[model samples]
Target: MAVYVGMLRLGRLCAASRGVLGARAALFRTWQEAKLQSVRPLSSREADRTSPLPIGGLSYIQGCTRIRLVSKTVGQCLDATAQRVPDREALVVLHENMRLTFAQLKEEVDKAASGLLSIGLCKGDRLGMWGPNSYAWVLMQLATAQAMELEYVLKKVGCKALVFPKQFKTQQYYDILKQICPELENAQPGALKSQRLPDLTTVISVDAPLPGTLLLDEVVAAGSTQQHLDRLRYTQQFLSCHDPINILFTSGTTGSPKGATLSHYNIVNNSNMIGERLRLHLKTAEELRVILPSPLYHCLGSVGGTMTCILHGATLILSSPIFNGKKALEAISRERGSMLYGTPTMYVDILNQPDFSSYDISSMCGGVIAGSPAPPELIRAIINKMNMKELVVAYGTTENSPVTFMNFPDDTVEQKSESVGRILPHTEAQILNMEAGTLVALNTPGELCIRGYCVMLGYWGEPQKTKEVVGQEKWYRTGDIAMMDEQGFCKIVGRFKDMIIRGGENIYPAELEDFFHTHPQVQEVQVVGVKDSRMGEEICACIRLKNGEKTTAEEIKAFCKGKIAHFKIPRYIVFVTDYPLTISGKVQKFKLREQMEQHLNL
Candidate 1:
């Protein structure tokens, strides 16, 4: 035993010295052999059933699995909604001053579909959209929605055509395209042979045409002139609910984003279900006007915000091209918007605006505050100040067409604020012990796993990677640590991978962040672990203070000293003006770690 220990020390010493390349190579080989000897790989069948214990009892809850799903195509759903409410306003772009009733919107959608078909785009063809939300954006989207669900990850999924804006505000999208396809300047609109993007044959531009891109209006006109009604009808007739529509990239807070490909059936039902949760019914005469400020690139915006509104014959009001608090406020007041959608940070910013009280947002009765868990204070403030009395919370990932859990209307303030509410109909969730990989008892903190109609087909073109998160029995491991009550309410605690181990102590950063949020100066707080040589990892707190508030790191530590365990107290504290967030409004903690590492020169 002494000789083995001495040999391990000698190998480490040799590997650390630059002159001993041969010894370093030998040491690495020995380490690899040791690792291989220590671990055994699970068989395919064993891996599928993660629970060694039985599947029944307190470990799982199948959410209304017997409920029937909407078995219609996206286009069919839109057509049906339009038929039911032809004269009702279907969409309103407040920024563009464009109002289209259901019938008019359907007409535009059919024309756009015909235009896409005329331009050689067929069923199952990939079309990429890159721009902020607008009427033109919606037209192009629904046009594509007729045949296919537009995916978010274009390059990874290898889209056949791309429809993007020539420019949006300060962003020159065309200029970036020129960099990728230098020959785009010389190539024809429909026949592009670029080295960078070989699969791309067509480039369609919204608002205006670029040198190598076709104009959107021209596409619509081309379809109008073509004798292709039969062809469009043929494509629609053969379409199925199970067909792949869109591939949304999971917001990569910890690692590289994976493309979660969703089917038409997946999104259509998910959107309708979410809409139902919002008390929207197409049969009702009361118009549900929704003010959406989130981006089109994410499921939160595309599925929950836009598609849900369309499915329920609700009038969707786009506040602005991008989220502007002022524009959102104005749209809600002017349009008499009954619903509003945004993240907690967005709501916080809107609440912080000095002239916020000046706007009359009395029309807003309900909306969703999703992407992250909303603080209790933020929820109360939104209800009290923003007039969102029926405001609820939604929780899910991009992989599930985005919503698996939601707070329903009848839920009390404490239930809505403390928990993410009950599971959606036709879905199933389970809590598995993180270390044991077996089912845990109810109310025990464990990894949350989901299975249902909402789960994506898989990560696009990466079956192995897809298999890693989604088990063989079709359960997609959420990686979120959560506790489920007997009544089925779930309180998300933290990420499984995000769990911090400091000197053998398990620490969940979310708990620390939640406690820190109670501090008077803290507007927002994110806790992460930094590498430490003495311990495995040390807790670091990154905080965004409330406007005009002042506090020191020492003050924060002093506050935590007596209230919480010493092991959980953040050793490092940082004050920042803002946090790095994904387009969907989720904080990118990995970016924070990188910044902290750079700041500490670790």
Candidate 2:
């Protein structure tokens, strides 16, 4: 997930049967008993039980469920889970051969938190965590705040401290820090005085001690004293659920990336709901092990992977510091992992591995495929080949605590492949006509808007930008063209800005991209609008072919002809090896458009 290219020793902690198959068999019986004794039945007001709106009715719905929200901070949630399942396996970094139980993980987090406090990092102070997914990364993610984009994010949020590894792959973090803050070379540990980054006062190295920086072990040791322990306890008293815990920067495809601030309340409830939907709450730690190859820095890993596992008391397995398809498969087979999280591209890479068939991935039952629009073909392939029958498609942005819609385990294959599933509980959604500024009819494409507890507080220090999308009524305009069907399933069509208007006819590129995915020769495709002198814009399809397959623009065009509307057919087709992608794996369509425009001289 962090783009490193190295092999790590495989961990064999949970490689054996471990009675997982027996525990899985007991899962349903346990769930039934739990439901009968403690769980409440679904209310009539719940979204899934309600009747569909009329065909011409407004595309608006609310997920009114009986599930109460978790009124606790992130730290509090972790603490409660550790108390309940102290001996359960909490985290396993297979590549690093590191494993920690729930109690041990909490101990590590508290030590890191105390260490941060010792270094002048207060509860509200910003601390940027920069590195790949590892044991240290997990500690920092739960112990304090996180950030990305080295210089921009540090300055934007006024980071008070930074936790980073000594070196990741080819990038030496200390060297980069020195280049950014030249005074770091001469400053005393925990007493940095810099001109470029004035707010930075401390730097903690995860690997080893460096000049002018404190070693992670040294800081951890410093926190073991009675004085530090008392201070940490006192500091925890002032923590609030509404306090911002994470500041994730947007992809910045259209503009400079803005930090979308998320509160503890937002992510805690979101993660719990996601886990409940996935039925993870029904399984014990031994019965459910999650293999996450996505970067911990991203929301998919932090909120979806890490927090969800914490809430459900499931085992979290890290296959590698960076994403390696082979390594991920090996982890799944060796650990007997039950769930796997990744983007559509990551899944493609995994399935394309030459020895993919050799791995025993049958242990996997469910996970999430998100971060971009997954073609239906890919979904079917994953279900058939990967043995992930309950695999769900999730849709959301970083601003919404990253998950708004997800498929239920019992949902039909068509629903899973075609739609992003129903709205999450406690969330309200409506499709609005961009021009009319009113709710659109069911099954009609429009800009999707969501209002919920999951909505972010606002962009960090950008009120005007926040107001531009989030209205006074609290509806966060998604800027995504989507349609809600009669059954309340939502299908994202395309980005509003990416929609092409050719001679007054609207064309959504996602539809064409989905169509092209059905082609036998195509592995992936991105359709973008190209500037045209006559019709204002024309369609350009950039496609990546399957391995060992060859095709031409004429053949691709021929495939599209007669299957779709004439105007929907691409005017220009170009074969591509890959599309420009963000670190989180979302295709940068703006960049793709720019490249095509330059190549065509348009």
On TM-score, the candidate that comes out on top is: 2
Q: Model 2, 68: alpha-carbon shift in Å?
A: 0.2
Per-residue lDDT for 14 in model 2?
7
What 10-residue stretch in candidate 1 is worst by lDDT? 1-10
TM-score of each: 0.87, 0.91
In model 2, which runs have C-alpha deviations exceeding 4 angstroms? 1-56, 142-148
Top lDDT: which candidate number? 2
Q: Candidate 1 residues 22-120, lDDT tens each?
A: 101111111111111111111111111111221335757766533357765556666666777789897787877888887776666565566666777
lDDT of 2 at 585: 68
lDDT of 2 at 415: 94
Which lDDT values do the candidates have, in the order given?
A: 0.66, 0.71
Whole-structure CA lDDT of model 1: 0.66
The TM-score measured for candidate 1 stands at 0.87
Candidate 1 segments whose C-alpha is farther than 4 A from its true place: 1-57, 65-67, 142-153, 282-287
